[model samples]
Structure formats: C-alpha cells, structure tokens
Target: MTLSTVNPDFWKGRRVLLTGHSGFKGAWAALWLCRMGAEVTGVSLPPEGNFSLYDSIKDQLTLNSNFIDIRDAEKLNAVVKKSNPEIILHMAAQALVRRSYREPVNTYETNVMGTANLLEAMRDLAELKAALIITSDKVYRNNEDGHAFRETDPLGGDDPYSASKAACEITTASFAKSFFNDKGIPIATARAGNVIGGGDFSEDRLIPDIWRAAREGESVTLRYPGATRPWQHVLESVSGYLVYLQALAGDDGAHLPKSLNFGPQGGEVVTVGEIALEVQKAFGIDSNWSLVNSAQPPEKSYLALDASLAHKALGWQSKWAPSETLTKTVEWYKAFSETPDIYSFTLSQIDEYEDIS
Candidate 1:
C-alpha cells in the first residue's frame, strides 16, 4: 500500500489558472506546476511585505503573471476568459486570523464573495474540467473537546477568518451542485490543516515568527501555548490538492465526493509549545518563548482533522513525520539566510519531497 503522487504526465501541456500565485503556498504550487510542464496563468495581487517567498522566486517561474484583486469581478472575469483554462486552483484569500479581527468585512468579502466571483467567472469556460477551492481546517466549529472533525461535521466558527472560510466552503458547494455538476465539471472544496514550510513570511504564523525571533535575538511571544493543531508541510496538502484534481478530471471522478479533508494522519497531536521546542531544536537555538501577559483575542485550544476519507478515497497520506518536517522547514529558512539562489534551493526541496512521496 504505497502513497500516490501528482502525475506529471497529466499536467504536461495542461492549461491551469492559479489564483493567489503571489502568496506563499501559491508560489510553491506555481513552481511545481511549471516544472511538470503545465502552462500556468497566474492571477494575484502583487506580493506585499518586504520579504515574501513569491518575491524571492518570481523571476524563476514562467507563468502568465497578472496582478489584480480577485474582488474586482470584471477584471477577474476578463482574466478567466482570456486564460481559457482546463483546471483551476483558487487559493486567493485574506488568510490571517488575527488580521481578520480588525478587518472582518474585508475578510468576508475576500473569502466568501471573492470565491463566488471566481466560480462565476469560470462557469462558462468550455474547456474547464475540474477545480479545487482551498479552505482551512478551522472552518469547523471548534467545541475544543479534542474531537477530530470529519467532512460531515457541522460548519461554524467564531473568528471572522474561520467563519468566512466556512462561508466560502458553503458557497463553493452551492456552485458545485447548482452549476458545475450540471455543466459536467467536477468542482470540489478542499479543507487543509495548518501548513508550515519555508518561505512563509506572513505575520502571525509559527515558523516565520520563530525565524524573526532568531534573527532579532529575542524570544517569540506565544499567544496560546497549550493549543494543539494538525501541522504538515505545505507540499503535503498542495500535492493532495493536485492529485485530487486529477482524479476529478478522470472518467470516474464525477462520482467522487464534493469535499475532502487533507491533514496529518492518525493521532499525532502536538501542542504549540511542543512544536516550538522541536523547531528550536532544528534551528539549534534555545527554546526561547514566553507567554504574552496582555489580553488577546480568543483562539481554539485544541483542533485536529480526520483525514481517513482522503486515505480511503485517494490513498493519500502525509509522507513526512513531524521531525522531518521541522528539519526541512528550518533548513529552508537557513538557506534564505545564508544563500542567494533561493529558487534553486526551493526546487531541490520539492524534488526531495517528490522522491519520498
């Protein structure tokens, strides 16, 4: 019983429209898809922040790059029409939880309505066969009772980010049933766990926070030391998405489920504090962290996902254990700090992952 991989033969010479290609996960996906010989048309806002993975490696990718807001329906529709893609991977969103608190309206607009915009734009593309809407594991209502959420679990959330993603899932499902299914296109939404990897310089994330602390000679402040999350490398979930999309485009794909979950398999629950210690060990630095004494917004104390369906249906399993994931993640940050050819290092990591997958 071996794990499956993204078939490069299927991707060769395929037309793909990838939104959010300027973000962390999107950048990795763009590079991988291009390496597999897919002609990618990228639609995303220009990279923000001084240090972004996309900015570091954009020059190395050969995509039809366009910088536009997904919220702009007219422009997005124009791009969709122009691209005439066979497959679409929609990952654009305001993806930070803490920032969603300050700008809840913007978050909802981007996660919910923005999803609708993409669906609307692509529905009429005669060449389209399949699409995957990327959501988060946090879309489920967290009872915090140490329950592993299944695909059939009730959807609700307290924070703006999670709630908006839940809404996005619902919206995409509606479009899938009402439009895509009728049009003979297999469209599904995928919920993934907390993805950690190199090149994620986004604010309010674990690995990037730790890297910043090491650079500044200070300890990263912890908001929820006791909270548990399902952690996996970004490529694990990305490859899962690619594999599932290929399945959907197959002859029997229309009979597949409309939504699937991708997360680390089994009862591998590690707390935030424990992961912090492991990452510091990989960095060869002291486990330096202290709790923030000030009041902060509420967060889930325990969260996990049941990826049994992905295993049964797609035969998908996470290849890297927590230790290996941490080692590779830390190694990437170190490469960024010490080396200049990040594009080459990133490609090597991708090749390493493919070798094992």
Candidate 2:
C-alpha cells in the first residue's frame, strides 16, 4: 500500500504545540498541520537567516506564534500549560554540525537541556496524548559504511552536534521509562536523514548552498564530493512522522516508548557528486563547482538509515524518490528565484503535499 497525504478532517479541531516552528523543516510541518485542520501554536525564536518560511505563512495559517527560547524552562512550561495541547512535536534545537563544533556549550544546552525542559513541562499535562521528539540520523555512531543505521544500533557521536543529539535520545528513553510508559503518554523519537526541500536557507547544508551558488552564476563547492547520504524530501519524512502520530494516538501499544528511523526507499542512497549533478540538471544551469581550497572540518564519509522497521511496523515508506525529491527542490528554488514570494510558494507546497492524499 502507498502512503498518501492525510485528509484535513483527520486532525480537525486537534491542538498541537510545535516548538521550533520557525526552522526549515518545522515550517513545512506547521503548514501541513494547518492544512490538516489542526490548531497550531508555534513557539520559538524569530527567523534569523534569509527569507523565512515561517514569516511567509504566519498570517496565512491558523497559527498562534510566540517568540521565545526553548532553553528557558519557565517560559516553555507556561506556554505548554496555556496551550494544553493534545499532541506535541518538539523540533527546536541547534541543528548544525559545524556550528555545534563552534558552540558546543550552546548545542548541548539547547538540544539536551531543551529536551529535558520540554519533557518535564509535559509531565503534568494529563490531556497530552502523544509526543514525538525529532532527532537526527546523526545520533548513531557512523563507522563509514554504506549500510544503514538501525533503531537498536549503538547511540554515540564523535562531534558536538551529533553527540548532543545522542544525549537527547538517552534523555528521551530515560524519561519514557521513568514516567511516560505508565502514564500512557506513549512518546516516540524520530530520526530522519538529509531532508531537502524548498525555503531552506541554512548554512552548511547542500541544497541551499547549491541554490545560492546557482542563482549567483557560481559553481557550488564540495568539501567531500564522494561522501554519500540518504537524501529524502521534506514531505517524505513529514509523512512518516504523521503516520507515527496517528498510530500512537490510536493504538498506544504500537508506538509505546520506542524509536524509529525514517529514510528514503530501499536502494535510494546516492553519493554527493551524483546529487550535485542532478541538482545542476534540475536548475538547467551550466554553472560549475569545485572542491574547497582551504581545509574543512572532519565529517563522516558515509551514512544511511535502515527504514525497514518503519516499513514493516508503521507501513510507512518514502512517497517520493530521490530524483523526484531533487526535482521538487529545484522547482521550489526556481519559483523563489523568479519571484521571491516565499510566503505564497510555501503555502503552495503545503497544499501540494496535502493534495497527494
């Protein structure tokens, strides 16, 4: 069976409090929730980088946004209490690996402590039915293999950013054991790899950097041209998260105190150079790119996620293939390139994803 975009009434009148709703993936998820007819309350800091997807859809969606820091437990707790949300999706964190290297302390505080603060705040909320904590595929220790990372794989990270995410995973498991399992909250952790789509202007990411370079008539730079990853679209990961939530809300036994990995379809892994070539073709640009001249930070050479469990248990697999995902990404950037109407473009994609259901 294939996965389709969910119907609007599926989430009608449901309340969802999403932290870090202003980030790239979070913004896309927020727009989709609004389309699915959920009352969405967004809590996070203001947009920091270029044209933000959040800023684009703030007025269009039924969003109650509050500018605050997740690290501040007092503020976060107050907001969680006020919302009394039935579903919670925690996406707030310092997400960059290179940046984490630069600010290790901030990374730990935001990723680990921020998670603990949210779980603590939700502890007393009796109405809360399910909570999905968004972590990274990087949480697993990579031994430079093309094989996929499994759910029960060893959770360890060499770098500050990945290590901090690993810490969050441990905290989540401990919290679920200590309280959630018996309390019937049924918390789950999500780890998805290399999600790419529109409206992302973050640093140190591939698609955004490629888009920027192509727009400026310059070639993209690659530090690790041969590195490989599980490249999936944003909606692919979003669909898995929604299905997991649906299972948790329906049959608690299905998702009780568990962790799941969402990756692209089997045999979908592609090398960085191949993806760059596809991106160039999508952009229709003859622009060139080369390796970095100076030294670069060390990163894993290869990493992938074993999504077989998600397929077997949740019946969830990637809806869009890698080529389709890259095409969609290029299309979004092309629309923004021709006319920088980020708000309209973001809403259109949300509608597009929902219509697939």
Candidate 3:
C-alpha cells in the first residue's frame, strides 16, 4: 500500500484520541494524522527532556492537547467524554526495560492498569468505531533460539516492562471479549518491533545512545552487542497501524483479528553490533564501541517477529530494508545537527516516505 493509494477522504474530519503524543512514536503518528486532516486530541505527560519532537511541532500544527497521565482515571475519562473521538490509539506506557527493574510497580500500574482505564473510558463513547492498543514485541517469551515469534506464540516476559505489556495484551483481549465485542466497537492490540527514528533522545535506546556518544566524542557502549533484533524505521510501524485502523473503520469489527504484529521482514534482522557499525558509517563517524562487562537485567539474546499474518490480512509490509532504515535515521539526525528547522525536515521525510509506495 503506497501513500498515494491511501484515501485522504477517509481520515479527513475524523476525530482521533491519541495517548502518549509526547513520546517518539506517538509524535510521528500525530504528525501523520494531522497531515491527513484528522481532528486530533492528544493526552500524555510532559516531555521527558528539553529536546523533544512534540515541542518542535506542537505550535506548527493545530491540535487539542493535555498534559495528563494515563493513570488518572477521572481526568482521562473526562477528556475522552469531552473529545467524543471516533478512533482511539493508545500508545502510553512505561517503555524502558532497565527503568522497569528499578520501578516494577510503576511500570505495571502504568502499562497494565493504564490500558484498562483507557478501555473502560472508551466503553461509554457511542461514536468510537475502533481502538488500537499499542504493545511491544517483548510480550512474547524468548528462548534465545532463532525462531521468529507468531501471534499464537506463548506470551511471557522476564522483565517488568515486558511482563506489564504482556498483561496489557491480556487485559485488552478480555475487554474486547466482554465489553466491546458485543457493543459494536472493535478493539485490537498492535505489537511492533524495535523502532528507530530521528528526534528520539530517549535514554537506554541504541540510536539515541550512539548519537550522544558521537556528540560527546566518546565510544559507544553496548551491554548486549551480539543480541539479534528485528529493526525497522518508525514510519513503517506507524504505517501498519494506520492501515489496521483503516480496515477496522471500514469493516466495523466484522472480520479483523484481535491482535497483530508489525515488524520487519525475515531478512531485516540484524545484531546490535551491526546496527552500531551501520549507523557509524552512515553518519561518517568512526566505528568505536566497547562491550560492557557488568551485571545487567536479563534480556533476550535473539528476538524477531513473523509478520505474515499482517501481510496476508491487511496487505501491510515493511518498505525500508535494514540498511536503508539506518541511512534514513542517520540522515535525519545529521540534518537536525546542521539545521534549525527540524519540523520542516521531519515533514519532508514524511513526504518522501509517502512517495515511496
């Protein structure tokens, strides 16, 4: 599905309620929705750092935004009631693994209970046609083998962040079956792989860490250099979400599945070390990385997702290969480092991505 083929009339004048609009992926989704002429209401906490994509584009686009935590059920419900949104895209969560180890209770409360609160609030909105709950690919149990995970794979997580997301999947399923399934509102959960993009200064992530190290004139540190993961551009995953939401809006929950995975193809899987080297070369920096020989929380050494279900069902496929993904990501950061107009640069990239299809 190319960008030209996407019907603009479908999203024009559509009311969308997006959670976590201040974060990396959420900000990208909000930008695309705004370009499509959707009336957007964003609910999320304030930006974690001084440099944020949300800050760059907030004034450029007209949107209804609130700085509220998802755990605040009373305020969240009130916002949802006031927005009267037709579509809900839930992306708010405690997304880091290392931080989860230090604050497990906070992770669970935000990921699991926060999801429940959103769904509960949506139950009364008669105009809501579809709700897509965004979860992580870490929800699957990893045996360190090379087998790619399927939708039917056993749901398990060793870390608090992953476990909380797994519990969210369960909660979304239960809510779908008990409440929305019969009420004519389609609720589905999306699990996406490791997403890399520009303007993401989140700590403990690969791309941001590499950019930081390069700026500081230091070598990049890797805790798990040899671990393999499915890597794709942020736009790829967000495109999949838009396609899934379009399907739900058109069908009204008649034939779509409850859960789907949006990830790279089989050949796009690469190791952490490979990503570091590729980014280094892309940014014209020397390759300098050292392995950390210290204790860290347990994480999967090998992880990948089988997106054949999404392909056969929704005609969704990743357009960018691993190498191209790296190049585009580095290019974005390099442009930002050289130019002051990040909002225009980002919109240009989005326009370029839309023309690719």
Evaluate all candidate structures by whole-model CA lDDT and list the values in order: 0.91, 0.84, 0.88
**Per-prediction TM-score:** 0.98, 0.95, 0.97
Model 2 residue 330 distance off true place after TM-score fit, in angstroms = 0.6
State which candidate has the highest lDDT.
Answer: 1
- Best to worst by TM-score, what's the order? 1, 3, 2
Candidate number with the higher lDDT (1 or 3) = 1
Q: Hey, what RMSD does candidate 2 come out at?
A: 1.8
The most accurate candidate by TM-score is 1
Distance from true location, Cα of 31 in model 3, Å: 0.6
For 163-251, candidate 3 gives per-residue lDDT tens digits of: 99999999999999899878777899999999999879898999998988888888888999889888989998888888888888775
Q: What is the C-alpha RMSD of each candidate to the true structure, in Å?
A: 1.0, 1.8, 1.5
Q: By summed lDDT, which 10 consecutive residues of candidate 1 come out lowest? A: 280-289
* TM-score-better candidate, 1 vs 2: 1
Q: Which segments of candidate 1 are over 4 A away from where they belong?
A: none
- Give per-residue lDDT, candidate 3, residue 10: 81
lDDT of 1: 0.91
